[model samples]
Target chain A: MLLDDAVLRAIMRGLHITGSFVLFGNCVLQGWLLPAPVKPWVQARLRVISQGSFAVLFIAGICWFVLQTVDMSGAQDAGDIWQALPVVAGSTRFGGLLIGRLVGFTLAALALWLGWRRGAAVLAGAALAAEGWLGHGGAMPGPVGTLLLGSAVLHLLSGGVWLGSLPGLWVGLRGLDMAQAAVLARRFSPLGVVCVIGLLLSASVQYLILIGSPAALLNSGYGQLALLKMSLLLGLLALAAVNRYHLAPRLPMGDELARRLLLRSVVAEMALGLLAVLAAGQLLQLAPPAMAAMLGQSGG
Target chain B: MKLVNLIALALLLGISPAFAHAFLAKSDPPVGSVVHGAPKMLVLSFTEDLEVPFCRVAVSDSMGMNDAAGKPQAVPGHPNELMVPLNIQMPGKVSVIWHALSVDTHKTQGNFSFTVTP
Candidate 1:
């Protein structure tokens, strides 16, 4: 069954990652692109992506929480809720991450509420940044976690702007005036550059977290999947480069071929993003590189 | 929406107490039961499936004596229940304690006492 218990867990992980990507992507678009002229259309699209993903993420998150609680070991039952609360609050790094994630989620929800007002997009972006921080970034400890958290915030903000522009590009290609499309392209390109930089930075931090030693890249499944994700991201970057350097500048010519090329490249990038999301889901189940080594040490 | 949020908050608060893993529900010898003759075996029942490898059941006499037949062995096909055979029939109060590290990494312990009379 596609929805079997194990599959459900995987699916929950996938939904969480995908939702974060979409939310972050949209926030980037709203914050970076969406020049005054195209703000309305961009805002509408952002609303759809953000709210829709949030609903799915909320439901999947609830399901995951239920499963975890129900399957907790009997030892957890010894304490009352008041007692358990402190234990859960104090137990593992995972617990702290979970609490942080909840706080981030609440912030995101508040940002969504504020989006109907002026300058609310910035607030929404901040909330999305926080979301990324708490989700996987907070899974580490001390300085490493803080670095991950900051990089993730920047990564999410930039990703939001970059990925959020896809639909806009699609719409622009369909029937929008050439001059207006060119204008939007000009506004988006620089932001896309900045977002790419942030993505690369956060991605490097995540890789460091996952691949402790160069040897682990070959030794562990987590490292292998991480390598695969890195390859896909590189491919995406190459496509973005083509779009930025080759295709974007030719928009004034109203060339259908260039538009199609951009569209195809964006589609490919989106596919690669999906693969990255799946890899992330798999990675969640695997121990971090340092932890894996520690386990090996204990066993040996 | 406000009401829905309130309901959700209530549910979250209410359900926090319900999180529990499989626990020892009952024991065959029964806690503090006094009986004549040594028990043949000790059987433990739990609330959910257990990873059997980590489970152990022990029988100890009044002087802190271990009366294990050999070693704790799995009751084939019943992962949740662990059994250990008794070697000697003694007429004394005995304590049975179960210890296990569950699959979820939670450590579990449950104990009961019974007495053998002459």
Candidate 2:
């Protein structure tokens, strides 16, 4: 039997959150070829994780797209979805962009297998960025649309570079040399700063366009969820700060305790970042104040 | 490459013709206007084509009277323009509430009131 509508929606939401983490996790691994190939065993295990995440991301993405077709077609039953799918994919902007994501990600996955690390990273990042186009920003008109989509896309990719890279940082820190770990930490700090700046600017533009008034942050479901996401992001940033100023300096001095502490903070940061992403998934489902009559609003 | 073709097509289609959720751009009788007589129909222009089945428009007067609005229709050759026939005789302040579902499945709703001095 087919799943209930609620069940399918829940599955789609879950897929979005999980797929983002995993797909970006795979992307994160490519920056420096973590668990380097010189150690064949570690590299092999990392590849397996990469492969599994890619598979999950692909499957979940397909299911999510199919659900959207059913939604747009207003299909009452599974059988009708077959007829609706072609029209949706051919005609709608959402469908076309989604197809583009599918293709980009597929190529990214293929490139990863072919050991084209740099190319694969770029493809995956672009795919991740493209998802922002399916959100509220991409639906706007004229130069406003261009501005919003560009900011939102950059916001997403910058987020990926920051949060998506955390899991890999944890892995990279494992059984790690003190000097090398310190160097890695130092190297990422500048990139993280740039991403933080990018995220802040883009998020402001998005809030202006989507939420309209700052008052909506307290009043609407969409605003409330965004509030929660921002709270979680701030929590992550706090943890990151602790790791950056307090612990990282100690690592260069061959302090084992500092290394462990940094790892713990990184883990906490990653966990909070994941929660932020989950909140984002929920926000995407809710209707922004800019639309809707404050009741029965729909947009995905 | 297929990916390139698909991305190019998506960019061209999205950037040129479509944007986001269908927000009410303008409406018949204009919002909160004092008109001389009762208008026979309500016209709504949105930012995007609507999914007419789920989209709805209604006009109700202050004196607990509801006006008849025929099935909402897309204007001839105008996918973005929606019109609903309205029947109103005795009118005071006519309240209009519209809920629109864009063809992309985004839904938006709002309500406004207009005075009909008759």
Candidate 1, A16: how far from true, in Å? Answer: 2.3
Query: TM-scores, in order shown?
Result: 0.59, 0.73
What lDDT does candidate 2 reach at residue A156? 82
lDDT of 1 by residue, A81-153 (tens): 3343444445433234445554555566556557532234554455455555334444333344455556667
Per model, how many backbone clashes are there? 6, 4
**A162-216 per-residue lDDT for model 2 (tens digits):** 8777766776665446666777788777777877877777776667667767787
User: Model 1: DockQ against the native?
Assistant: 0.02
lDDT per residue for candidate 1 within B35-60, as digits (tens), equals: 67777887776533444544667778
Model 2 residue A92 distance off true place after TM-score fit, in angstroms: 1.7
* Model 2 spans > 4 angstroms off: A1-14, A21-25, A32-38, A294-300, B1-20, B27-44, B48-104, B109-118
Deviation in Å, model 2, residue B55 alpha carbon: 7.7
| Candidate number achieving the greatest TM-score relative to the actual structure | 2
